[model samples]
Target: MHGANIVLNGCSDRGRLDQRAAELRSAHGVECLGLFANLTEPGEVDECYRQIFARFKRLDVLVNNAGILQDALLGMIPTDMVDRTFRINTFAAIYNLQQASRLMTRNRSGAIVNITSIIGTNGNQGQAVYAASKAALIGLTLSSAKELASRNIRVNAVAPGFIDTDMTRNLPEGKFQERMNSIGMGRIGQPDDIANAILFLASDLSAYITGQVLGVDGGMLI
Candidate 1:
């Protein structure tokens, strides 16, 4: 195992999740710096990156994994809900990429993995805004990859389906089960499933791959 030191930004909120992550890091002997930042705010992002640069002096990987979903049909969705979803899910990724790419271009080597969703590729009812935000991320991934490829920066995305996370746990059990049955694997995915794909994208194993959307959905996208 490479004792790769990492700064995990955006882990400060949500009931002190950073505390638990820090505990795990201590147990594993990994240097994990957790910072608090509201990703939707540019000023917070800037400050977070400044802290990272001040400490690490270099950034090798950026995982744009912070996202929110407001599920409502387009006609029924409130303007505020749509705007908030885009601000956090889509725009935040772009803003992070803007800063991350600048640092990466200087190093001429970095990897960016955006967390997307299968709903982005295959539209779903009552998830218009969420889907749209993720779809925008896919586009951003491709465009950023093309622009950063010459600099040796790889930009890619992972589209997850029916993942068993706190977000999905809030769904009605019956509805969640129904969705799981549609997956070819006959089960929901885990966060590690997406995380593993992210690890690969960040590792040298995927050195030649870029501008790709690796679907971690059990054949759901097909």
Candidate 2:
């Protein structure tokens, strides 16, 4: 893998952010810039992109990984919660892709990887809002990939299934076991599993690929 300099944008914890950046620098010998911003706001997202271009003068890859979950049954979900979930998970990616595509188009090349979810592909009972938001992202990925293909910009998505992250860890033990039972792999996926797939789509390995959604589910969708 290329040891590329990266911008850790929108990270709020300065202490932890700096600590991790130092670790990356020391371990991987890569430059890391930690910029704090609110992605749900278009202005803030724009500002973050502006800083990236101002410093690096170019953008080779864009990964839309910021998302929030507001799970509830469709009938009981509040209107505000639905709006907020879409605003952050769907609209925010659109805003960033618009800006990133602009920069990537200028260079005539770039890769964009959106972090979607398998729930987007197969609807979940209590995750109607979250699934809808992620589904929107998949649509964006396809449309953007087609629109930007002429400019040599590739747009794709990674749909992870119940990865073991801070969010998934919050599930009760019984519910977690049920989730594991649902997966054919019979084990929870780690964050690195998703990260590796993102890296593949972001790299030349998938240079010929676009408008595709790679499911990183542990055979859950199979």
Q: Largest TM-score belongs to which candidate?
A: 2
Candidate 2: tens digits of C-alpha lDDT, residues 1-222: 488998776556778877877787888888887877788889998998899889988889999998999779868999999889998899989999999999898899999999999989898889999999999999999999999999999999999998988898999999888888899888889999999999999999999999999999889852
Q: Tell me the spans in candidate 1 whose CA falls farther than 4 Å from its real position.
A: 11-18
Query: lDDT per residue, candidate 1, 101-206, as tens digits?
Result: 8888788999999999999988898998899999999999999999999999999999998898888899898987778778998878988898899999998999
**Model 2 score (lDDT):** 0.90
The candidate 1 region of ten consecutive residues with least summed lDDT is 8-17
Q: Which pairs clash inside model 2?
A: none
lDDT: worst 10-residue window of model 2: 9-18
lDDT score of model 1? Answer: 0.87
The prediction achieving the highest lDDT against the true structure is 2
In angstroms, give how far residue 27 of model 1 lies from its true place.
2.3
